[model samples]
Target: MSESIGPVLRVIGCAEADLPAGPARQVAELEAAVWPGSSPGHDPALTPRTMLLVDGAGTVAAALSLLYKPVPLAGRTYRAAGLSSVVARPELRGRGLGGRLVAAARAELAADPAVDLALFSCDRPLAAFYEAAGFEVLPGTVLVGGTPEEPLATDHPGFDKVVLAAFFTDGPGRDRAAFTGVRVPLHPGDTDRLW
Candidate 1:
């Protein structure tokens, strides 16, 4: 189902076919507009996932990608949803669109029995925003590109040392913890910190 928060904001599920041909390019443009040089992955269409679009007055204002199923780690299996490519138009900040998009994404994930947790990376400043939305700061170090030296930075508050956060569908540790204290490699020089 879809939801409309107001005249300027409409939330709806979009299919892979609905995503434009150059989604990576489009996502790059959105990331650049908001965070300058961070390279976000653009492969939602290649995965078993759902895309949520937040449009403002018929224009694409924001987008979120949610991936379902287990993420295979070194020796463990974890059931979680991967959230990525969350973006909002540069001119539309502070209007509650981001939060609304997150809420909608969370709601969608919660309804799925296969998903036990939600995982994503965000720069420091927006950590509180996600925290307020029901995500808790997982204890551990986040290494960017498998190197702890390349720290992720952002203007969102309380996230200066955090590069990512994991939100549990049933609280922390009740279900398996995906990638606990694990390092996920990011692309080199891709510092667009918008998450």
Candidate 2:
């Protein structure tokens, strides 16, 4: 665990069975704070192959989940990593905890030979933050389940409504090939609705 200004960010590779209930609850709380209306299910724990936890003065500040999955993009087979459930405590925002957690996850993902690409979905406001972290924006529709929808928005049509936007990622150059101006596939979980 590495201590930051107020919290200690620890990257843990623990199975679902190993994480205690207290930490799990904290993770859920942070998730809810970040994404309203999203259910933080209790039964199936979020035990990503790689997880990062940020604790501020003994309290959970931020966390991220990473999973290695096969992603088919542009008719090519890519062993990519899915980054999900990224959240930071309301009081901890702008402290760089989110960026730190993401950087840690990226490093870990890059270490795995099978993980050639990393993917995640973020609202428009945070797009700049991700770009600063090395992710480049792509112009395309994100197919969620059976429907292809628009990019994430807060109001109007709401998150369920599709919008014209694209995915972004840190260009693959440091170790993996850079993905510039590439149309990659993004699976937003729901399978019945086509975006």
Instruction: Name the top lDDT candidate.
Output: 1
Give residue 144's lDDT in candidate 2 (0 to 100). Answer: 32
TM-score of each: 0.65, 0.67
Q: Using TM-score as the measure, which candidate wins? A: 2
Candidate 1 clashing pairs, residues 3+ apart or interchain: 37-192, 38-191, 38-192, 124-159, 125-156, 125-157, 126-156, 145-186
Could you tally the backbone clashes for each prediction? 8, 15
lDDT of 2 by residue, 1-195 (tens): 343433355555454455567777787777777777766532222225425454543466677666444556655666655556677888868878787777766666666666666665556677777666555544343433322454322222555322222122344443233233343444333421121
Query: What shift in Å separates residue 89 of candidate 2 from its native position after superposition?
Result: 0.8
Model 1 over residues 31-111: C-alpha lDDT tens digits? 777767655554442343435454553466667766544544445455656566677777877887777788778777767
